[model samples]
Target chain A: MSRQASFGAGLWGGALALLLTGCQAGLRPIAALNQPLSGLGDSQSPSLNSNWLALISSRPGSRAQVQLIDRLRHAPVPLPGLNRPDSLPISVAVDQRGERLALVRQRDDRSELVIHRRSLQASQVVPIEPAGVPQRVSLSADGRVLAVEVSRGGLWQVDLLELP
Target chain B: MACTAVTALGLSGCSLWPLRRQPAAPAGLAAESRQQPALSGDGRLLASLVDRGGRTTVLLQERRTGRVLPLRQLRNRQPHSSPSLSWNGRYLALLVQQGGRRQAVIEDRATGQQHPLFLPADQEPQQLSLAPDGQSIALELITGGSRRLQVFSLAAMLEPDRAPGLLESGGGPPLQP
Candidate 1:
């Protein structure tokens, strides 16, 4: 090949190689999860685990409540006997099966922690020892362990409870 | 020689351009009045607290579709706060206020059962988080002017609510509830 022609081929070859490499290693578009959900009312305190999501929301002419949504089904799961008319839900956590829930509420004259069993249709009060006040609660994925924040002597402390 | 120089210039140009890219910004959810948002591990669901008509409530929405889900059981409760969800959204743990004090409770969605954690009259609950396995819970408590965080094992009290595929994958020995 002539010198000029060879130079032309080399330039084209370099450019083509660059183009092909760029296509192979190019950046991917943003994920759909990064997108925001619009047209929502005043809402806050969102918690998600796996395919389930739980949050607190209040709409016009409605009371504030804890809501649960199944991400796989894109629908709200019904929670019976969880919210009481005279009580205000302060915090909430959900298990993997959506079968067990742990929450704290203010009722009567004090704050307490309760566990709701779905299969048995029963609600039980898990008591804190040492007579300390309870605040926030967290549950393990297997529903085997519970972490709680307690207040004693005006200081914050964390306690682990083994449920039976 | 001219071709060689042109190729050199082109290769150098590529180096001059910035290569480190910034992460994409997260999309906005709603306007003001929304706070304390939590996302599931898979990023499929979102739960948030919204203020409406002077009351704070929990809202659950599918992140991809932006569809609002209903919470029929909590409709009557007011001023809900600090929401947490387990893997698959099966169990919801939260705190509620009744009368003058705050209480912690959990709602099981599968069977529509609500469990109330009972604390001593003097011990007051403030905030809480549930483990995704549905086996354990961590709570913040206040007693006699001090605050503390605690974790409790639920193996004896409640059955294991493991995520789908976890058990099949041999995650662990099943606990007898």
Candidate 2:
């Protein structure tokens, strides 16, 4: 075989190898259910008798979509984006009656807490501050209070606030 | 030269896997979650918060199956006037916040209207539960360095307060000053 032919074949082989490697990385599924979220994953699975709300990660690259699963049927629905545009879900929660939900998203270098409610059968959304990286949130039994857990300078504090 | 042949064979071998992959639902999940759950003390209903266009919302399921029927999505998705029940289960309550304030909404087993109860969104309230009479509610509230377990009379919570500022609960502030 000619020396040139051997060299060309080797080049083609290396190219193919690189392409396969890229595909593998793209297809890999990564779940970041680690240190940051605390035991949120376990505490807020679908089975808890209350209405379920979660900050579910959807296709990342295409869009950082946040999905809310109606625990009743396990179907996911999309939520609107944060005012920051690039803001993404950090934590999620539902009120006891499942009539309200709140999500904390980090955008730019700031944290923003957005709460949504379907009251009087009408839906409303608003951004609340002190919104730095929230770890977990839950609704009270009457769906009135919202308990928020936030880490400041690596220290954790739980805030029990009226969900106004 | 043999290395070239080996390489091609290796490439073909990898093609054995779905090299041109199709993105799929997360592993272990068979289908979209669609579960209308049973309400506390109530029989069967569904309730949850659903996110739409970056906005979040609470939803109610009024059937035994707890599934959002196809055409019903429209009515349910309507401007959602107030925290209403998705399904009217015997007993279900939801915590809601609107315009920087929080309120508790309780629903009976079979109605969608936001139940008129004591714990209206009139003042600051946190962690609320309906008592047996269904008239009263239990709440945990936080005010300037204090976390108090306040069980307000249902009627007091419903009616506008007599004095303004902060209503004092019986216990000496819970957390600390």
Candidate 3:
């Protein structure tokens, strides 16, 4: 073979090998967490921590309610006194042990932010000083700090509150 | 001549390669009706919003097994939204609507207890996120016709919920699955 032909063959062979390798590398399987659920009625607004998954789902007869799943056990954890028949859940956040939950719900024609202590079986109203409308909420890892989205004077702002 | 032949062969091989197939949806969930998805820090659980027959709700699924978990207390509540979970899937925080108003609440799976946080009468909550350790929370509120974000410290009131075998601030090799 001529010098030019030899060089061309080498180039083609190298390119083919590279292409095949690229295809193989791109075939990694998708993670199961990224996939969607089936049969459940209109499940949405998912939040996850290290070992817990929380979301709102409207199953057969229920309208909409918060659902908590233990990632390690692959089962749902029951929560008592959090969901009320007259209340509508808006947003949810969980702590590490699934002991403390921060929730926003609409009730009696008003919106409020509350901290629910599972062990104590009590709910405390987190008052936003200067009185603003609370929207979304997040809890720190230790459940020591809280981040709140508020609306004041028709403008949106973020507030950091100290929990006592 | 050899070079040309080799190039032709390469081209033919490329053409014969099959196209990559699109990934199929996980076994049962064929419809793409899910929304507002959140993943746990460990990536083992997923929470998302879905609508069924004009009603909106939340669903919690085990990422690896695609199993749907149950929420017994929330059965009566309708139109739930926004969800946040702790590191171990132990604490769950969410908002529930009551009449024409909304309230914030939390559920501790380990204790099977639910706690509700009440804001001032004038303050209205919009959205919220919980820290991984369940020590602090950030919330968005609307007051006086304006919106703002606030963070509250819960160290004084609640026990620290830490993940198992969690590393402090020290530097070390990342943990492997």
Candidate 4:
């Protein structure tokens, strides 16, 4: 009887240890994409779906570029005239369908909300209020409602910009 | 009698362990200094930023059960700035500063999948919103002098095997003429 009690206690203790470890593991990413983006002063901002990844990177002393990489094809899509050497990308949002792309670009103190339709091969720039500089941006799935965070005189405000 | 006393003592000790008492969203979180309450579409869950005891944490709580989800990833930050739940309450998007860059991340509750969304440099995400269809997310970034809005599509990210529908079929207006 004493031996059985000892075995049972050991089993319970081991089960407790395993349970604690599992809880401590927390959430983890299934896969982290490896890209050849480097040599920048800041970290890269990348948004990925299961297949495509849109990453923003700036070369040494050059303007930032938003590059789209196809995960299955393992190739980068060539976007001619998309990279503006004179302006910097502030933020980028891709739609669920990977059909639309929205980003904020800044030239000096001025900023504009740029929407790119991948399928149509066209883009648009919406003018923003000149009172403050545009910072972060998000677009709705249908590409109808746009939200921009603007800072004026040291205060942050959210601006909802509707696309026509 | 001695064995019974020892067993009771051991159980009591385990129950009193500090690790066993999980950290939760304290009361009065909505009244904190800077609170952003994001309620789910069905109004079943609410995700909010709470400043408790000089520290800021993002909490997701079930309205009826009063049970909070244990989001350990958000706890690593000194202050988890902004948290927004999706319309379906399946995904959560928030901002955190990791590796010296402020980026947004989306977490799936059921699968515990945490993926970081991309943003530009020096532009910290100030606010986050998931679209009603859960196919896109909106972020408001605050840079040095300007602020901008960005929308990321979840359809491609979520459904990689499917082909994207053409825009000319009358989905949305073209940005350029």
Predicted structure with the largest lDDT when compared to the true one: 3
- Give me the displacement of residue A75 in model 2, in angstroms: 1.7
By lDDT, is 1 or 3 better? 3
Q: Which residue runs does candidate 4 get wrong by more than 4 Å?
A: A1-32, A35-43, A162-164, B1-78, B82-87, B93-177
Determine which window of 10 residues in candidate 4 chain A has minimal summed lDDT: A26-35
| Candidate 3 chain A: 10-residue stretch with minimal lDDT | A27-36
Alpha-carbon local distance difference test for all models: 0.56, 0.38, 0.58, 0.55
TM-score of 4: 0.49
**Per-residue C-alpha lDDT of model 2 across residues A24-135, encoded as one tens digit per residue:** 3322211221222222221111112223434433332444434444444544444443223466555555554555665556667665555665443332223223333455
- TM match of model 1 to true structure: 0.43
Positional deviation of residue A34's Cα in model 4 after best superposition, in angstroms? 1.4
lDDT of 2 by residue, B1-177 (tens): 433543343322211111111111123222332111122222132343444454444445432334542222223332221232221233344455444555555544433434433332333554443332232333444444333323333433222111123333542656546
- The C-alpha stretches of model 3 lying farther than 4 A from their native spots are A1-164, B1-25, B156-158, B167-177
Task: Supply candidate 3's per-residue lDDT for B77.
Answer: 60
lDDT of 1 by residue, A1-164 (tens): 69999999999999977764543232121123112211224343344444555555555777656666665564566677777776766666665567667677777867777777667655665555545676765554455545555565564444444333
Shift of residue A71 alpha carbon in model 3, Å: 28
List model 1 lDDT by residue over B9-104, tens digit each: 332221211111111112343333454444443334456666657787777666556677666666557677766665666666777776687766
Error of 1 at B103 (Å): 1.1
